[model samples]
Target: MSNSNSTPLMARVTLGRALRRLRDEVNHLTLADVAATLSCDISLISRIELGKRNCSQQHFTKLMDLYGVEESERDRLAELHAATREQRPPWWARYSEVITAEYERFLGFEAAASEVFEYQVGILPGLLQTERYARAVIGAGFASLGPDQIDALVEVREIRQRQRLWDSDQPLSCCYVLTEAALHFQVGGPQAHQEQLQFLLELQERQNVELKVIPYAKGEEGAQIAAFRIFRFADDDVPDVAFGESVAGSLTMDDPRDLRRLHRLFSNLSAAALDPDKSRDLITRIKNKED
Candidate 1:
């Protein structure tokens, strides 16, 4: 609802509608038929038809072939996918070389998200990261990337940060819950990490953004094991999604069951984490400790 101007959602909806229309025209395959072909569940197929799940590249390809779609239509769908991935880097930074192919895909989806909710148990999400911090994290994580690749990746990352300008028909709204340990973890040395925390404090004041903290003392309840981000599209038709990452790659889930699980986790996290004012205070405390 916030992104009344965003075209990505509309594009997604248009694709879903087209997919459904094509299916209907061909004696209408049951959910089972699509699921069997995609190696997913019937419910997932239903969600995809309803525009709740993002269409994967492979799925798009298969569907086009199956429906004998016209070249023009295929091209339009492809354009939508590419447009959804486009981003403008920050004026001061560049893309990162350490970024893997999977993360890049996730970043593309993030760029077009109408709203994002993140639960971070370790480090800050990339959107809230500063150039220095992001560089340090990327460089340390992947020592193999050549400087050229790293530079290119950093530029891409900076461009992705322009999600701030997200002003689609459904503007982006983001909520983040950061763990206390992430504050004192001392990533990129004291100064860079401190600045990152400070940046988070400033970012909290922006419209449509909310930052909360899960203090160390909160114990088990505050210790949500992994980090995940949920992206919700603006169009009424598209389904919401949750993305999870591991050391090597990440996975995206849009199944109704999976989405429901993530939604519940977010609700619990929001309740357990500190409110905005308190979260800001905690970050300030961490920054002052550095001083």
Candidate 2:
């Protein structure tokens, strides 16, 4: 069995997709064929292609040769494989006990994303949330977690914001659409909520950030849609990913059909939302009302 962690790493996912595509579209090879060449079981090939199992170096090289991957592409795939074998854990690995494997994967994707389109309801998106607001939200949502665990998760959020949003040399372009109700919801009580709105106003001034709000008057425009985010990577080899979460669990979808649906949903929501200038105005109005 290939030595691989149970948790899916972002590079592994990308590599798997690339390999799968090459198998299906480029090489027109079947699992059985590849397995026979490697003298391994078809299931093993399937798992490696699905990213559930890591591809060994021998198999990787053999597959690349079989696929007739271009020199440049071979170099890229080699780097991805090397990344999968990285000895150092990601920054969020310390909080692993507190966060789900899926969430950890999400942090990796979000960190690497070049752009993010997020639609949120009920509360502000994590990137836009204030520390106190995040604390309250995390505490209430994860009531079973101990105080320390909650604190660790909050710190993870702060680190994510700093690295991805505030401190990055090329900060990811972010487009956020939130329901008006999110602004009105007093998540961390009046003071924290007010601060959160003020922070939103400040973030709106950022060149790479775009904030919009869907007012109640818009009615059902975005009412039925759950919160979700679409992450776009700079690497053309990696496809865009659509992620949604609820109390049940989180889901990550990269199928072209799903991506198209989410893109359409986001486009409609953006159309229905207030423009950035008006969004700032409404947020200011709400903040003043809180005071």
Candidate 3:
């Protein structure tokens, strides 16, 4: 499988999806069939379909021949070929500066997405974090991190949050589900936890936002999983993507089967969480304890 979290992977998926749509219009030519025709491994076909591998002009020519794509459609596929260069960012690109290469790709995808659905079991999602809260969280996780590194990480988090509401014609919509443990994590001690919890409440009031909490009693349901986000696009042009962190790195899933499983997981998790008002009340009760 390709490194799914890479921006190039996303571009590849966009290209593959366009090709797959063209293939579907022609007939039910399965990927396996295409691989057999190309005399390649099934894994290679899967990677091509998922945009995990870059396709060359020769590959494009082969696809046009196999799909019986028209001259105009051929032009469009060529456009995808053109995008190979377009997808590479400039030498001065800063969108990925402070983060790992894989995470930088994840950030690029999140920034470009139209909507994001996330669940955080251990701590607050970076998008909803305040500078102090973010720094504290980062420091806690990396005791060896210098103040300068923490500042840069916080800067990235802040930039990502600002982009969420970036006055674009297409602003990102966010739906966040957080666990009670997140509210009490105390990254910057009790005061910072209170402020962060308050920020969550305020975000819940936004038109493009919805926030919920899985109370402490929810136990395993609340704390069993690591945080993850699902990015959904308005363009039928692109497929929905799910990004989850691993010991190796973050993983992005574009395959319909994989996405379906993740979607189901999120749905069940959300269903088990408290509703917004109740979640807010749960947070308020926690805050009152600190008073």
Candidate 4:
């Protein structure tokens, strides 16, 4: 992603994980026992724990009752359950006039996620883009958009950055791993590129941000995968979500296998990337270079 605001990176609550967390707190109630008490199928409970399906209201209420959850807590859980299963289009769906369905779905999860980790292989990821760089990137990619449409898109990106940094009630924590080549492939003019690097330097000062760079090294050269992001939620109710995109479309998954692969790749990327301080130094050098 070249813009500073690509996909939203917040966790969408998962009823299954939340329910499983609660059930496990019931002092060793067996799975069969819960099914028997709730008069539901045991396999259904397993699916719920895996976040494979949504639970019905009747069953959800019964589960809450079985867990002896507080009335107030039950009210909140009920609301969240309803939201997760909302039949209405997600907030981003309105942007379907401008964006694809895959991108729209990504926004839903990104908006609600608490923590986001990204490994960028091409240009800088959207979260770190400056306005000028963002404009340059947008202008190049979608030459067809009218000035008004482009302006609207840029405005959305700015709002996205603000929300992640501080505008939202809960600020998003971001860890970004960028390829060293991204710095060399400048988007905006020299001055704007320099300014973007300076902005990155400033952003690195924030406690919630971690920026690392993967240099062109021998053994790790082929290890870098396509850019992907992992979003984690504040509560266990939502399973961690992972997303990646290609020329065709986007791929998002919360399956255990998918998550495991992302986690391992992220871990490896962290190891391969330069530490924050070194990454900053590299950026400074690139910025200072005569363009």
Candidate 5:
């Protein structure tokens, strides 16, 4: 099977899905059959269909010929395949040495997401985190990291902050549900914590950002235990992508069943969360308490 360590959004959206559907419709066309037609290993075919790897133009044209895809459809797919390789690398690619395969892939899609939904338990979401807060979080988790490594992580986080939530003309449409525990957790002492809260208050004023707080009184659910993000693209054909991180590590999901479950849980959590006005009021109260 193919692993999705760093698949791009374009390949995931068009090439992989179209090829998979076409392969499915034909009778008696197994991975073995496709591999034979492409003159490669069966694993290669699997990876191409999973969007974990891209086939050469020759291989792609050959497969289309094998599947007997319509000329018009093949042309569109060929164009998309070309674009996939041509798309510029996301900013995180520069920091690939320090970043995990999972996060690298997350950034690839984050760069393309039109709408983002997030839920957090005990730490601020990366897009909303302040410089000091991000530094503290990274430092605490990677205690052995040197100053240079720490600085790079902070820089990447700041870039993500600007691109995803603060860009004046093209910011992502964001909905965030922060648990009361996360609101109260002090990452970098009272002053730093207060500043982080103040930052969230300011970000909430943006028209594109929706900030919500799920209070302790509202209780918790299983979904609240892990911080996860659901990314929605503008085009309907591009399926929603879910990336989640927890003690066990991170994983990505595009399966409809997983997306539906996460979507439902997000809906319920949103319903339980405090509204924007009230959430800001809560943050203000916490900031004042720190003073």
Candidate 6:
């Protein structure tokens, strides 16, 4: 089951999409039609369908009645509506001082994801990063923060790894496509870098984790793309979301068009990357060179 505390937004999105589908495909109704039926402004209906606003209990029941929704489907949507209205604080709520709201939302998605597809150009993904490597990366990126803040951020990364990768009953299935340059970047000096690569090797032994390296020979296949991850959930109602990291902040998108483009880009990168065994060999060779 998806963790409700970590996935309320996901539920909201699912409910919104379902409402929109019912309005369009089933009833063939327009926003104006829904608005008129509910006796509310069209913008209210639009925002509700877009997941930007919550549907009130009265409005929700009225919409269900307006659409002539069947009992079973209405019950399911009601559960999703309840989930969206849940007020439980996420596990990362304590770290609110250190992380942005956008990042907190990403964490929520990550915590609820069953599988993750990631592509990195210059560094290891957080779930695969060693503590020291994480500290170094966080410290550099958040250079203005004090040591305590940096340590707290590092703790956040460690907690994320533990909850999603190590401690979960069903560990998150992960496929990572990384550029060869990622292995060579040496984020936390030679010792920490070496440890990070060795850790990657060990992680490859796990059934849930798969790592592939895009050799330098592959050139710029993934270079043009910023680091990004595609998160897939177990629930079909909650659509897959793509997250991109940038200097400014993180961006999350669930638009089908954007998802299709990202999917195509990831497919191309994966096809151009080295296979698992060879990718492991390349990592080992690089680690040896670090000695």
Top model number, TM-score: 6
Write the candidate numbers in order of decreasing lDDT: 6, 2, 5, 4, 3, 1
* lDDT (Cα atoms) of all candidates against the true structure: 0.73, 0.86, 0.74, 0.75, 0.81, 0.88
- Displacement of residue 86 (Cα, Å) in model 3 is 0.9
Q: Which stretches of candidate 1 lie over 4 Å from their true place?
A: 1-14, 17-28, 31-101, 165-171
Models 1 onward score TM values of 0.72, 0.92, 0.82, 0.74, 0.91, 0.93
Q: Return whichever of 3 and 4 wins on TM-score.
A: 3
Predicted candidate 6 versus true structure: per-residue lDDT over 1-291, tens digit per residue: 355324677777778989999999999999999898888999998878767688899999998998999999999889888988988877888989998978887887898889999999888999999999999999999899999999989999999999988899978999999999889998889999899989999999999999999998978675756899999988776788889988887888888999999889889999999999999999999999878
**Judged by lDDT against the true structure, how good is candidate 5?**
0.81
| True-structure Cα RMSD, model 5 | 3.8
Which candidate model has the greater lDDT, 2 or 6? 6
Q: Which ten residues in a row have the lowest lDDT in candidate 3?
A: 1-10
lDDT of 1 by residue, 157-222 (tens): 666676443433344688888788888887888888878888888888788889899998789887
Taking every candidate in turn, the Cα RMSD to the unseen true structure, in Å, is 6.7, 3.9, 4.3, 6.2, 3.8, 1.9
Location of the lowest summed lDDT over 10 successive residues in candidate 6:
1-10
Per-residue accuracy of model 4 over 202-242 as CA lDDT, tens digit each: 99998889999888772465256588899887655457889
Task: Give me the overall lDDT of model 2.
Answer: 0.86
lDDT of 5 by residue, 1-291 (tens): 011212355455557777877887664488898888777999988878777687788888888888888889888777767766765776687887789877777787787778899988889889888999999999998899999999999999999888667663567889998888898888988889889988898888889989999887886542366888899876555678898887777788988899999999999999998899998998898888877
Q: Give Cα distance to truth, residue 44, candidate 3, Å.
A: 5.9
Worst 10 residues of 1 by lDDT: 1-10
Residue 222 error, candidate 5, Å: 7.8
| TM-score, model 2 to reference | 0.92
Cα lDDT of candidate 4 equals 0.75
